[model samples]
Target: MSFSRRAISLCAAVTLSYGVISPAIAQAQDFNGIVDSVHTHAADDASAKMAPLGSYASGQLAESAAEIVAFHAGSKRILTVNALSGEIDVLDASNPQKPTKIGSVSAGADKEINSVTVREDGLAVAAVQQSNKVLQGEALFFDAAADDLGAAELGRVTIGALPDNVHITDDGAYALVANEGEPSNELDAAGTAYVADPAGSVSVITLPAPGTVEAATQADVRTAGFEAFDAPGALHEDIRIFGPVNHHNKPSLDLEPEYVASAKGKAFVTLQENNAIAIIDIASARVEKVVPAHIADHLQVPIDSSNKDDKAELRTIPVKGLSMPDSIHAFTSGGKTYFATANEGDAREWGVEEKDGGSGVYTDEVELADVIDNGQVCEGVLDDVEAEALGDKKVAGNLKLSNVSGWDEEKQCFDELYAYGSRSFSIYDEAGNVVFDSGSDFEEITASLNQPGVFHHNADNEDPDFDDRSDNKGPEPEALTIGHIGERTYAFIGAERVGGIFVYDVTDPANAKYQTYINNRDFTVDFDEDNYDSTKLAGDLGPEGLAFIDKQDSPNGEYLLVVGNEVSGTTTIYEVESVVEKEPSTSGSTKGSSNLSRSSLSSR
Candidate 1:
């Protein structure tokens, strides 16, 4: 129990209700003068609070995480990029729920590390790549006061080809990344080839402040007005690539850039398979307007499509699609400047299944007897050989879809089958428009908070039948961030196949609300009979990335959040505290009602 007495008995102490003041002038009111007589006492004590407070794991079962960044100069480190050990790790979160680890750096053999950035005075950056069919990449840097957790390189620079995410702006001045060109699986003989097409762009990194010498180059951001965002030609022949691969003097070049969020000075990014959003600026690194990101309208937007039975259902019908986002951020609230996305949809193809018969193909699929009839094709998204070779017609539509792919073809009916992730979480306006959207409200709030065969459960299971990712992307919200905690302004998001973390209240970006849902993912253990022992798990799996910090830049003085967990490599750390409601159990006297007590700040 002693982790500082379970972190001071789980926080508790935000009580204030002074009306009948007299007991010797309310005991001469001095607990630092009642915390300096409330100047809106920490946003009225951190409105709608939060809890969790503990978790760390870092690498046990197949270590897989991609984004996370935290700093606070003298102590609270964090970093974490490890996409299967390409490396960045460095924990020691100044103990926000026992973090430890202390080091990591690698990015050498098979290098994969996908994104990290620091700059709170410790200075850092990362993106490192190679295996996304090796178009090559690199950005790596860190000099947090002359390196300790193996962090001081600052020179690899290259860039472009699977960089997938990286940022670092708040006045440290530069660093962006997002090169996601992703393709690679070479085929041919009727299957097509070229997988690294046009090599997506957005690199930047000029960061020259704190104790200089960090030159860092790479800033192309591809232009010619992006040659009209091409993307299609059968999604470049099912991700096979007959197009851009580093812009062959520019013709079509599909914009891939998947995530980068820099604040006010601009940046934004997230082209996630060309469902667009570019913005840029940051002192003229370029690309000032790309926008595109539209297509929500599934009958006024409501969705939960795991294609029919990956259950947690939400539907809404008559479709349109592509809010296809993936990890986005940019915060500010009341003083405006929004941004939040996690639509989590993506596309492109390669192939395998004993060489070209499975997991590949260039997405041209269409056939429920060519669009509809055999009982309107929904067969739990068929595929036992397309539901035993089309018995009642199966393989529905795909043609590299999502430009609003709710297919109708004169009533053949793809009516609401939209596809590719607008499964929810939005809010834009930096010209990206749409100010609020949580439609299907994360599938009716994770099926009214779990337990009906545990909504969407699939971390290799401990019961609760997997349901194969609900046919395609339900609960796939995937990473977002934003914070303020008092005087409103929340956001969070992060679902990634229904694992957890939703918290909304967007301080009125046109009414945001939905305030709670956080998971740690132990779901009764057994990812194949335990031994993965993250203290018998039950939370934090697949969250992919989110960070908050704030209690004066937090070094654990409270108001944290953290999360990382790409399928349980783990990193939890919650503690947004702020509750005080007690006095409601008086009708009878047995004493079993429990209206919530525990003081300094803590709750489940």
Candidate 2:
């Protein structure tokens, strides 16, 4: 059902992107029962950014574990090689509850790593660490012995140190490793992952510049067109290509960042953190640009979020947000290109800094300016970006400000500059305009609120009133991701201060629902559904990574579900069978007299 103009205008406050209408958010709160009605959290969330044993080994965990295999299916049992655990679990979902645990292996000393791959021969190829930290060691190949369900001892071959990733050619006849492992800014840390083979062969790749070679690097030049390459260490035999990262001029962490993915005809790499996605041109050993977002070549990330209880010591550049971007992914759609980065909010928000860095100075100095019509460039822009637009109106002695992007559809740029309500999902178009907002749209949906509100962390419960223009403040999405399977699209959202994932269905693009297990017609399920009609299943946790492996159009032919665990340091895989669609017991009507409308909530 549609709303009258007056009813729809009431939602002017429910803007989709950047301050569409601040008054609406305030108005929702003023409604009382409506705001509190939404309260349902997802199930799994073991996240707590822990101080590492010697600094984190890697962020993007790729293990050949069972969960990984359930998501990526092939003739050979593939697993997401967990660098920390040094083991792989078999993700055979014949039985969902009891995922088989296949034998484990150990990443030799300081080799704490990030991603990994396994060859048809069961040889595990992983990206290990090589630096001052504990995981600093050479990328090695360990033969998997499934005897112990993953605790077996396997032989090893040292490939290269400070490694990034390891790759095996399709025929399995050749293997490659990318080693760009240099000490990260935070000592013990290295930005590079290497590609290597079991024969002790290795190749190092440097970070790619954001706009160094344009659109996307040529696939052939990604690895310099070499069938083979070697590390700097001892021998130089059959070195068909130059080193990926030369000692003297290694690319910055933000530039030419190395990451590998297999595409249709060839292997493509992403210069992550950088603005380009380089598809490897294996023949000539060069990389071609498949995507370029005009981002930093090597992301200039702040070293630490904290420097004691004082100010954070910031670096001299801006690769991402005013702070640092913790994670990133290479995403593409239609004919357009994009990259989704999870920028951990500013350090000051965390409330621990250095004296000189910021003594009582509130970085929350942001003021809401008049909403600009980004639909058309300058024609809609509001003047005075430096000053507030509420006409010198102080909101409880604080300046009034506009709401940030709820969901940008034009996603040409990274999702860092915008504001995604703490643990909210925002989808942008290739052009960077917000297209959907799961948070605002799913209003009243219990799963929508409690699931994603894991991060409404506000030291001060300062309320911002647009009607009166009060300063109601809260946290933003700690991290956000989109996953599409079949005709269904799901968003797994993470909260900053809180733990767990919020699942939202954006199949309709505008209105949506939270993935729920039980069919309930409650205020939290306000987006209609019919409100929990059992179209999809919902799970929870600090889901850092999400994948819909069972899409009909997918290359892999498996009905799978994969969720990355940021807290437990493990990727969970599930076989999501088709949902048995069913309507709830309630009729087509509003259970309570709340201002939230099904269409309005979903539309926003």
Candidate 3:
């Protein structure tokens, strides 16, 4: 089946009794139309309803998808988790453009999984935010791959803290959970999700970390890593929600959720604007440590030592450090598993990675990393390194970091960076260095450097026309995952706003190339070819997450790509064909365009 056709079937559209969750997702059902009132304790009992996909799904394919309104056996589907209205949308994209909303899981703020993921059992788990310091998001586990074909209300398991994300690994030995609590899932729901909330919760998960990895060889793309998105568990945070929400973390619960994940065992997360990536050991249910990474002062690093004049515009970007370690992929190196997040920062931040934090050290005994380039400078960013070997040093009571390092070499540069990178596909090393830094470097290369590469301090900043590496424009991929297309390696990137998927052939990291681009703006049986340019990017598809079912472990060699769009509030599924079965996709995708249309928040 074609990619678009499969994406359309992730969810089927059967009219279940009045339920919760719709585009303008409100507090209760009947949004604008005599909506029903909701009970705070009773979840899975909302009266809201989702709107039909606009004339957008107009092709014959959509008609096919409309028929599948429930989960089916043997079918690999993609599920959408909506944090705002507090619900889940399952799409049976066994057809793409004509994808159908098969089922809807209506719970309360209790079902909001900050992190949503599906596993081989055809099951998906959500970490719903809870209300306490002890617990975070609630864990809502349900059967997705099963095709009983009925309106089933799989009640959720109340996980007390905010379950940021979940992971199901290949070995299946364990499911990893990132419980980013403190304010807890139930703590603050003001900014995220189209809805509002006051608390958070987390779940319990454990995964075996792999062997060790070398710092210098961190950027090598040949290594295969593993990650899992698990379910939220039962439990509540340690704190109550009676007073005004915290204020320090504008978006967070007025608190620095040290780690996006703080579940027992292990956790790793990136703070987009915070300019940091946090790692925690849930063994004791507390943040073990934080890797505060920053960039080098490339601007100050004089390209020519003789040119004494200090260049002004040396660092093109001001927030160079990995803008946000949005999502992380952990792989074992040396003797341990190292988690690396996609640091989507700009050149200025990237350059600072090479500089030594001259004065301000978050801690006095920090192993101040020296910026590779001399004379460069930047503040508030920490040098890269995996979880520092904290032999016996415990910064906080019982909060100790693992000896393993955190990084991604695929996104690294310095002779190791891939030139023919499918821009935006980054790889961070153990020390949080850019082994393959496509996300930020791509911005710099196309804009200031006049090429696709790291943001050079330019030896001198005074020269106005030095180079613009940040000029190139393309899809701004947010979510990433590695998959197999036959025997080849593929990376599925979610371009939420632009509304399409970017497929990359990473069989050879050094020669990582773009393969296919799926158009996701509207039903595409009829689209204006004129509106195909970057600027012509059709708006409002809201693609968020991507997944492909590998029957390789099952009966059929079927592969399905599941997507959760932020705008449509729908999880779309797509069937991916292997290179052997079909040719690799050759189109550039439309990504980064915001899908900020027809959206609302439900306040409980």
All candidates' TM-scores?
0.31, 0.44, 0.47
- The candidate scoring highest on TM-score is 3
True-vs-predicted CA distance for residue 360, candidate 3, Å: 28
| Steric collisions counted per model | 27, 127, 188
Instruction: Give the Cα error of residue 281 in candidate 1, in Å.
Output: 33
Model 3: weakest 10-residue lDDT segment is 1-10
Model 1 has a clash total of: 27
Decide which is better by TM-score, 2 or 3. 3
Report RMSD (Å) for each prediction in the order shown: 21.4, 16.4, 19.8
Candidates sorted by TM-score, best first? 3, 2, 1
lDDT of 1 by residue, 1-604 (tens): 1000000111122233311111111123321111111101112222355555556665455357535655544556777777787887777777665667777777788778787877766667778878654475877776644555564665677877778688877777778887776556654434444444645777776677765646455442322224444433322211212222222423234567778887788888877655667777777667666776655665565443333243433444333456678888887755678788888776555544345445335553233333433454444443355433322211222112332244444754454444566767788877778767766556554443333323333223233244344445556787888887556667787776656676755666656655455554534444542465433334455677888878887865777878776665677666665343322222321111122222222222
lDDT of 2 by residue, 537-585 (tens): 1112233444444435223343444544443234444333334333221
Candidate 3, residue 76: CA error in Å? 3.2
lDDT of each: 0.57, 0.31, 0.34
